[model samples]
Target: MSLEAYIWCAALKLDVCNGTPFRVLLCLADRADSLGYGAYPHVSTMAEQLGCSDRTVQRAIRDLTAAGLIREGDQRYVQHLDSRYRPTVYDVLTTALVTLESRGDNRVTPNRSRGDKKRHPGVTSAVALRTVQEPTYQDSSRELTLVTAQEVEEDQ
Candidate 1:
């Protein structure tokens, strides 16, 4: 599957996007299927579906681009997947640019008096929670050995 599909899927996991953006992502993926890999369909398709001009689609693409969710290329764009951490393209793109992340163990006390209707000045709440996912666990035997060695040394 193309990277756009993966991006759109992740975006949907958040409950904030509107219908137009949803249609943009959906149609973009459909067109990507026909256009094949490394093919970025013209913005008109999104325009046609959303009943807006190509400029609107352009802006939406720009927003996604600025958000680090996609990478723009020569008259086309790539999903700019973060495959090093996860197999899927664009896995948690938001986390990469996240300036601040507050989690269950690392909670950031919000300045409730500071903003009447705002969350944070620099960080999105969605990214905050995902930050606590922690590091990968790839070597169980190594961890056991290290713990055992530490225990033995401490005993001595």
Candidate 2:
């Protein structure tokens, strides 16, 4: 059980994953180890826990694997009178960087007339104005280009 893995899964953007697939990922993350590996739960168990059908759980797993967000580990096999394949272990892959949108900036502003001074809004207009006027920042993929001023300063 790695808290870090769970937090990372929770912070993922909706564009990356949402709905059933997102829930399935979060469940795997909860059972993951410190290095974001070792999540082996039966499909039936996951279905029961998530209040969905086993087929639904399996579909979610397949979708997640297809998206490269998870990878199947060694297959578990059972030996005895049952002699059946056990639940498969999975590893959560976080190769893609996800950026979360701030709650303050996501709010939809109400439309107002140009000369409408009747609204006595408290700081909402100011925040919306600032957000509208703020310059868009593009993240560079170059390794040598620092994205923030707080990062390591290179000597000339």
Q: What are the models' TM-scores?
A: 0.36, 0.55
Predicted candidate 2 versus true structure: per-residue lDDT over 1-156, tens digit per residue: 778778888898999989999999988888876545668777888899999999999999999999888897534322222437467878777432121122232312123234546465455776756765665556645466446555545431
Instruction: Residues 48-128, candidate 1: write the lDDT tens digits.
Output: 767999878777766655654445322213334343322211222233223223233322222224343545555667775
Best-matching candidate per lDDT: 2
lDDT of each: 0.47, 0.71
Off by over 4 Å in 2: 76-85, 95-156
List ranges where model 1 is wrong by over 4 Å.
1-11, 33-37, 73-156
The Cα RMSD of model 1 versus the native structure comes to: 17.8
